[model samples]
Structure formats: structure tokens, C-alpha cells
Target: MSNDFYRLSILPHVAIVIKICRAYTNSQEDFEDYYQEVCLQIWRSKDNFKEQCEWSTWVYKISLNVCLTLLKKKKNNYQNFASDSLPEEAIVESHAFADESLNQLFDAIRQLSEVDRGVILLYLEEKSYQEIADIIGTNANNIGVRITRIKERLKKLLDGKIN
Candidate 1:
């Protein structure tokens, strides 16, 4: 059953899940834990998928919720640091990412608030503002405002101007 749903959700959206898990965790062990839990939850809830939105969108919602719930349970605000590199498979999965500078960009993005991180990740996936809003449960206008602010914040982080 898990394998069936994994093919339906995890295989295609694995990179998005990896990126979300990466931003929400600080260590490789924690990452693996989160990744597994997210996969488990997706399998657990597989039957509930209504096929209303794209399956990837549903996966994004589930992945973000799992990461945020785990973050809340751990009671730790994730750090404002970035990894020097990502897992090779994740890098290969992220076909949009062109160079090492894109890694710097993700580092900056990781410093954002959890909601901001979700918005930016969806935006990076080229999701419409409305799609992002629907996934994150906010208005499209609010998502637009948030994305604008998140971009400015990422700029500051990348410039070495922010602590």
C-alpha cells in the first residue's frame, strides 16, 4: 500500500519533500527522521486524497504540515544557516537549480520563517500565487505580500548584511 502511494506521491515530488525537510531540520539524522515520517503520513492518508488539486500540491501540503508539526513538537526554531551541499539525488531532482550559487540562494531561503519557507518553495516550483495560497491556507493577495517580503529578506541574508 505504501509502495502504491509512494509511486503516486513521493516519487514525483521527492525533491520538494527533500527541500522542505531540509529547511525544517538542522542535521542529517533529523532529516532522515522527518523524511520517513512524512512518507509514512502520506501513506497513512493516501486514501483521503480527493484528486481536487494536482497530486503534487496535495503532497506539498502534507509535507509542509508534517515538517511544521515536527518543528512545533521539537520546540526549536530552525537555525538560519544553510548546508554547503544537498544530497546528490536531491540536486539531480532539482533540475531548475543550475549552479552552486543556487545553493547559496537556498541557504538564504532556509533562514525564513516556516510559512515563508513554504511560500518560497511553492513559488520556486512555479506554483501560482493562488495555488500557493490554497496550499498554505491564505489569501492570494496575502501570499503575494508575503512572497515580496520573503524575497527582500532573502536578499538581506544573501548579502551578509543580516545576522
Candidate 2:
């Protein structure tokens, strides 16, 4: 039973960890480091998962926390930062238009504040406003307004770059 539980409960989080690492880091080394850290955190916190929310939601919260902690640490040592190693296959599969324009968009997203990046990532992931709010510890109403503003900002930024 314990083995079964471990397989079912813990194994599924690997993909989530990968997604979070790719979203947060720029190089392969950094992604591996972040992914390991996230896995360690999830392992340590497994007992604390009360199941108050969906499993995916709980995993997302853990990933967010891990990413934020790493980001904070990296900010102090910016010069030593490594580039992210996003899987080329994943990018090709998900971003059918992985062109120069898309790369520019990603670069622009990296310029935004951490909170904004989180919000936009959740938005792009097709999460509902309520779900995003719940994940980020904000109210649904606020998330809705913020999302609209974020969309406008992203559009303007993209337009300026593309045209």
C-alpha cells in the first residue's frame, strides 16, 4: 500500500516540476537545479499535504513556492546565473510557432515582475480566474481585473516589438 501510494501520489508531480522549472529558469543547469529543489521540497512536504484542494493545485502551490525561493536567492547572485534548458521537444509540441517573435515575447515576459509572470503563466495555462486567484492567494475579483490589465500590457508590448 505504501509503495502504491508513493507511486500514485509522488510520481505524477514530476511533469509539474519540469513545467515549473522550464517556466522559471533559462538554462539547462538551472532547470535541473530548480527541478531537484522542487522535488526535494515536495518530498519533504508530502506529509503536510492535507488534500484541501485538488492534487494538481497543491502541487502547483509547492512548485510556486520553490520557484519563488530560488528566484529570491538568484537575485542576489545575478552574475552567476545560468541559462535555462527548456526541452526542445516540449517547446516544439506546445508552441507551434516557436519563432523569433515568440522568443521576443518570452524575453518580454522575463522582464515583468515575478508576480506578473506568475499571473500570466497561469493565465496562459488556461486556468480560471478563480483558480489563479486561489493559487496566488488573491481574490477572484482582483484576479479578473488584473488579468485584463495584464493582457492589454502584453498586447501593447508585443505590438511594439512586432511592428
Candidate 3:
């Protein structure tokens, strides 16, 4: 790895990898494993990253793919995963709500299909809809509509409005 690449490409995105891993894996141990896996995948794929898309978008695709694969493998093993053991740094940095409310929101997010949760997280991060669509391979116009439904669903979950 070139020093410039490390300095420029990889360093900036470490937090994103952690966030994605946390959202996908839930457990501390699993988060560590997934984080390492994402790093490894990014390192291996660096040579092939044709620069056709923004670096962050490319990284997001790789990270999400790795996370989904891990989720599928874990599902086959019947192991339970909960997003309760969030990293301390993440808890300190999060501005969404109090711990209890954030926990509730995380629980609600977990109830969403993986793709929906991805959209919600990106939305929360204030990513432009075009960037999010590129990361998730969805139409930009559809993102707004999907987000509307997702917000309604999440609100129902949060309010105990879902029977």
C-alpha cells in the first residue's frame, strides 16, 4: 500500500467501516471481526478500484457486501445478534438522542430489512440522496419515496403503534 493511499484513501474511511460493522454485526466480537474483514477486503480490492466512482462509494459497496455476507453466514448458524454493545466512542459521538432513545431507535432499525436500515443510516448521516443511491445501487428518485415509508415504519415502531 502506498503511503499516499493509506493517508488519503484508507485513513479517512475507518470510522465508516466501524459504523457499518456496528450496524451489521451488533456484538463487540463480531464487530471487530467484521471490521478486520472489511479492511482486508478493501486492501485486496484496492488495485481493482477503477476510480469509476467516488472512493467512499466504492468502499461503502465493499463494506456492505462484506457485512451482508457475514449476516447470512451467521443466520445459518442460528446465533442471535443484538446492537446493544455499541462502541463507547460511538455512544459518546452520537447526537441522535439519549442512550435509551438511541437504543430504542437501534432496535427499531434492526427490525428493518437490511437495505432499509442502510438507507436510514445514510439519511441520518446527511448523505445526499444521489450519493446514497450510488452506494446502494438504487434510483435517486426512489430513495425519497422509500425514505418516507421507512420513516413512517420507524415512527410506528418507536411509538408502539405497531400492533
Candidate 4:
């Protein structure tokens, strides 16, 4: 795709990228890195899009893959670093939503397994089970089952944090 085509096609799905990146990262610096890497990967892989799926679905797959890959690398690097824990400054929350409940919800979401986090985020975005299944590369029925379990887990996590 041409630059203009890539820009126009990817523009509408920026929020998806931001949300996935934010969910995968706690620090602003790491979030920015994930966001940039995702955009770059999208641009680089634009030609690989075969139109078998909706543009937004492709964006979701790419964003999720990028975040998961970067998260793994970040974890590995952190293990090698001297500090056992990240600095307080490196643990900033997005705070994009000022609501305490929403923040707590996000905190709870962050605690879920990486795949579960992606599944719930896609579910929260109102993607159909089939659509989420397509993006996450699973059967639609499996998405339904996983979403149910993930919601239960999130509810249990949030119940403690919120109350």
C-alpha cells in the first residue's frame, strides 16, 4: 500500500492500538515504545494484508502481536537488569480515564494473563465472538468460553480491589 493508503487505512484504528499498548505496558516510556513499534510493524506489514479480514481486525492482530512480543522482550531484559523492581516513576498509570472504577478495572485487567488480557480487551471493545476468534486465531466457541472465564476472573479481581 502507498503511504497515503496506509495512513488512511490505519488512522481509524489508532484507538485500538493505544488501548492494547496501554494494557500491555505500565510505564509511559515502555508504552511509547510499544506504540511506535506497533505502528512501524503495521506499516512494514501493510503489504502482507491479504484482505481476508477487516482492516480493524488486521490492526487488532498486529497490535496484539506487537504488544505481546515487546512484553516478552521487556520481561527478559528486566530480569537481566540490576534492579529487582522498576522505579516508582516507571510505574505510572495511564489515568486517561479519571474514574476510579475504570482505573481499578484496568489494574485488574493488567493482572490477567497476557492472552486473557487481549481477549477481554477485545471483548470490551464490543467485537463479536467470531471477530475476536478470527483475530485471536481460535474457534468462536472457544472465545465465548474464554470470555466467560475471563470475566469471572476479572470480577473476582475487581471485587477485591474495588471494595
Candidate RMSDs in Å, in order, are 6.9, 6.6, 6.6, 4.4
Better of 1 and 4 by TM-score: 4
Candidate 1: misplaced stretches above 4 Å? Answer: 72-99, 160-163
> Mind giving the per-residue lDDT tens digits that candidate 4 earns over 80-145?
132224343443455756788887787667667678889999999999999999888899999999
Q: Give Cα distance to truth, residue 146, candidate 3, Å.
A: 0.8
Off by over 4 Å in 4: 1-7, 72-94, 160-163
Please report the candidate that would top lDDT against the real structure: 4
Candidate 2 lDDT over 26-134, as tens digits, reads 5566677877787778777888988888887788888888887685355433412332332233222123134867665665455455576678878887888899999
**Deviation of model 1 at 106, angstroms:** 2.3
Clashes of each: 0, 7, 0, 0
Instruction: Report how far residue 88 has shifted in candidate 1, in Å.
Output: 26
Give the Cα-based TM-score of candidate 2 against the true structure: 0.71
Name the runs in model 2 displaced over 4 angstroms.
1-7, 10-15, 71-103, 160-163
Q: Residue 50 in candidate 4 has what lDDT?
A: 98
Ten residues in sequence with the least summed lDDT for candidate 2: 87-96
Model 4 worst lDDT run, 10 consecutive residues? 76-85
Candidate 1 lDDT at 156 equals 73
lDDT of 2: 0.67
State the lDDT at 133 in candidate 2: 94
Model 3: residues with Cα > 4 Å off, grouped in runs: 1-8, 72-98, 160-163
